[model samples]
Each structure stands twice: as structure tokens, then as C-alpha cells.
Target: MSNADEYIRKLSFNFTLSYQMPLLTIGAYQNPIAVAMPAAPLAAAAPALAPGQGDHVFGDVIGTIETALQSIFGGGAGWQTRMQKYNSTLASLWTALTALDLGHGALPPIVNRAGMAEPDEHSHMFGGYSHRFQWQLCELVATGFVAGPTGANIEVRVIGGATKAWRKGVMARFDDLIGHLVDSTALAFYITSPTVIRHAAALVRHSAISLTAAVAYTTGHNGPGKLRVNTVLAQYASLRIAFESILLRLENEGGTRAYNAVDDSWS
Candidate 1:
């Protein structure tokens, strides 16, 4: 098949929204159900596919896979740089996703050795209910380790994009959350993900600071769960997946060359 066809096929594999779920009734129709076929069932989660947009979850890791395969077939100019980002983000995402429980969760019982009153009760997310805001901080694992902005301000807007217009002060809320999270001696997370902790630090300075033409599509997006927002979330997923697919393929093949190539970040 031609390169274009290959890329399309790769991107089309496992598409899914980043995170969202509310029993929203799609305007007035679900794409006019086919008489010849039974209607597709609705997804069991919020951030579900729009009605009739069935289960085809194209993972974002395809670019890496495609490029790695291309190198084997005599193509691919800068696959190494791509590989680092894809792999690290994939790792970072996994770490963040681990704390996936949301809603009315009891804050783990604490025995403060330092003798301090436990902060607010219940282990809940930003709003004390939905996890959508919590999902924004998926990139937190990169702090101190990643070459660019890796704090909470570096969450959803960075992961999703500036295009996603957040609720007023929403971004700042995340920034505060991250600050508290990293600083809190009471709440804690041990970096146990082999996927996240193992990778060497990366330096792709394209976060909230740089805002160059290359990654400058940081406008137009509404907040999560809003109409069309999932599309943008899926796009972010795709970009990271492109890099991860490469790293996974390389590890499987035991190809160690160019493993430490520079991955431009922050700028």
C-alpha cells in the first residue's frame, strides 16, 4: 500500500476520547439508524463515542510504529527524537491513570508521624465529583524529570491543548492542585510504573512556554465533556501514541542504536 494509505490505516486503529462520560442525549438523532441493521449500542462510559460512533479505538502510538516500519523499509529521517517523546508520555500517562478512582472515596486512613491534622476528608477530584478535571494532570510524572514545564499547569491544557477553552480559573486550579500534590507530605504516590520511572529525562520544550507555529494550535477547544472536545482529546492521544509505538517496537526488536538522541522540548 502507499504511504498515505498506511498512515491513515495506522491512525484509524483504536480511536477513543481521553476521558469523559455523562448521559448526554445527542441533539435529536444518532445518525439515522439503519433499517437494515440494529442500532449500535451506546458506550458504557461517559466520554463515550458520540452515538453510532462505535468501538474503533485507534491508539495514538501508530506514528512510531509506522516510522519504525518505514526505517526498516528505507525511510524515516528523525525517528529517534520521536521515539523518546512517545515512549515517555506513554509512561507518564500510565502513571497518572493509576490513580483513576473518583468520587466519594475515603481519604486513606492516615497516621501522621509528623503530628499534623489531616487535611480535608474524602479523596475526591477537583470538583469533588467528576474525574474530567483530574484527567488533565496526566503529565505530572514529567515534573523535575522532563526538560520542560512538567507541573500541574502542564496538565490538560498542555495535554489537550490551549484550544480547549477551560472554565475560568480552571487551569489555575490545576496548578494549585499540582503544587499541593508535590508538596504534601500527607498524600503520596510511589513511582512504581516501570514504564514511567525507567526512561531517561527528555527535553522537548514545546509546552505552554514556547507556543511556536509547530505546536501552536492551542486555541478553540472547549472544556472536557463539551461537544467536539473528545475529538481534540483523541488527537493528543494520537500524538503521544506515535512516539510510544516506536519505542515499543524498538524494544521488542532490541534495536539500541540512537536510543539517546535529543528530543527537543520546552522551547
Candidate 2:
């Protein structure tokens, strides 16, 4: 097969495998979910920022409290960096696709080939661009991830192009394409399934409940009905507790271990 054709085929294959494998193996097979624990209320650091005598304190205490809060939550820099990496990868893919002229086979490489070096950046050029053959029209369907500016927003601005052109019949073309691309990229980049923030919250809850149940069952902390509830709680805690029994025996003996559908907090 021609190099451009080969590249597209490979990309498509990669996309499908990345997106489908997780759903089939993890998302489908995994049961129960992890729920996030609510943040504990901050104890009174000192008093208020307002001034006071021997008992009262200055604004410094307030500042300290603020600092602590920032330290706890503001260090998501790693997540941002990983997102940038994903974006950069998408950008590279965009360059390749454009260079290959995937939109149409007949069209020559978008970038001129004259002299200087390289084999179509992947064998996209043919006979030094003297001849061009048009192939099937390539249309990328984007997922919301693109519009949401996921992966450094590369999926949208870099890959989808500054101006997206779709068939006239399509009304929600841009929105639809963005959604597909984002979902696909999230899967491809993180090896995880696409998920809404709500899913994460739900998973966190489920996991906690599952875990608590498991602990209760082992300890015999409740009656039959109460035992059933504890089992559910135990399953929720599976993300932390590795023992499968802790998750299973706790909640109907069928606890689930679900990965966050959203891109990993790291990637």
C-alpha cells in the first residue's frame, strides 16, 4: 500500500485499538467504582484575620492557612505537563496527516518536496511530487475533548485545523467532530476510556462504599442487612485496598474495580 494510505490505516488501527481495548477489557469487565472522599473541613487555623489581643491573632495566620490550601491543591503541574505531551503528540500526528495529504489521494503533499532531504516524512511523497493520485476523502470526527482543549488543545487547533469544513447536511458538524477527536485522543493518549467529571465522582463514591463493606464483613461489624451495606462500602475502597476479597465479599461478593474513565490524573 502507498505510504500515505499506510499511515492513515495505521493511525486508524491505533485509534480503534486504543479506544476499544479499554472498554472491552477494563471498562466492561471492571465492576464497582472508586469514590473520592470529601475534603475535611479546615480547622480554625488561628482565629480570623482581624486583629486581637493576647488571644487574637494577626493576618499572618490567615496567610499560613491559605498557603496550606494552595500546597494541597495547586500542585497539579504534573497533570498539565502530561497533557502537554499528549498535545504535542497530536500535533506531530497532525503534521504527518497534512503532509500526507490524507484529505485526498490525488493532491500532492501539502508541503513541497524539492531537494534537501527525508522520505515524505514517512514515504508520503511519490516520484518527487511529479505525479499525484487522489484517494478516499478523509474526515475526522472529533469528540468534545477537542473543543474542551484537551491534550493542550492540540486535538482541536492543531489536528482539526483552524477552520473545519464538513458536509452541508451536517448541522452539528464541529461539535460532533470535536467530541469524537477528544474521546479518541483521550483513549489513545492515556490508555483510558473517555469519562465525564461526574463519572469520576461516582466512581469515587462506589469505591469507598465497596471498601467499607469489605472491612465490615471481615470484622463482622454488622447484622445480615448491615453486612450487605458494608460489603458495598468495601468495594468502593478497592482502589486503595488491593485484596479482591475486601471488595467482593463485602458487597454482594461481586465488587467492581473501575478505572477513572477520564484521562488518568497524571496523563
Candidate No. with top TM-score:
1
lDDT of 2 by residue, 48-67 (tens): 21111110000111122122
In terms of lDDT, model 1 sits at 0.23
Model 1 clash count equals 30
Q: Candidate 2: where is the Cα deviation over 4 Å?
A: 2-4, 7-223, 241-267
* Candidate 2 minimal-lDDT segment of 10 residues: 129-138
The C-alpha RMSD in Å for every predicted model, in order, reads 22.7, 29.0
Candidate 1 lDDT, tens digit per residue, 1-267? Answer: 554334323322211121122111121111111112222222121121111211111111222123222232211464334434535554444434333221111322121221222222112221122122222222111111112122211111111111123322234333333222211111111111211211111221111111121122323322222222223333443433443343333344321111111222211
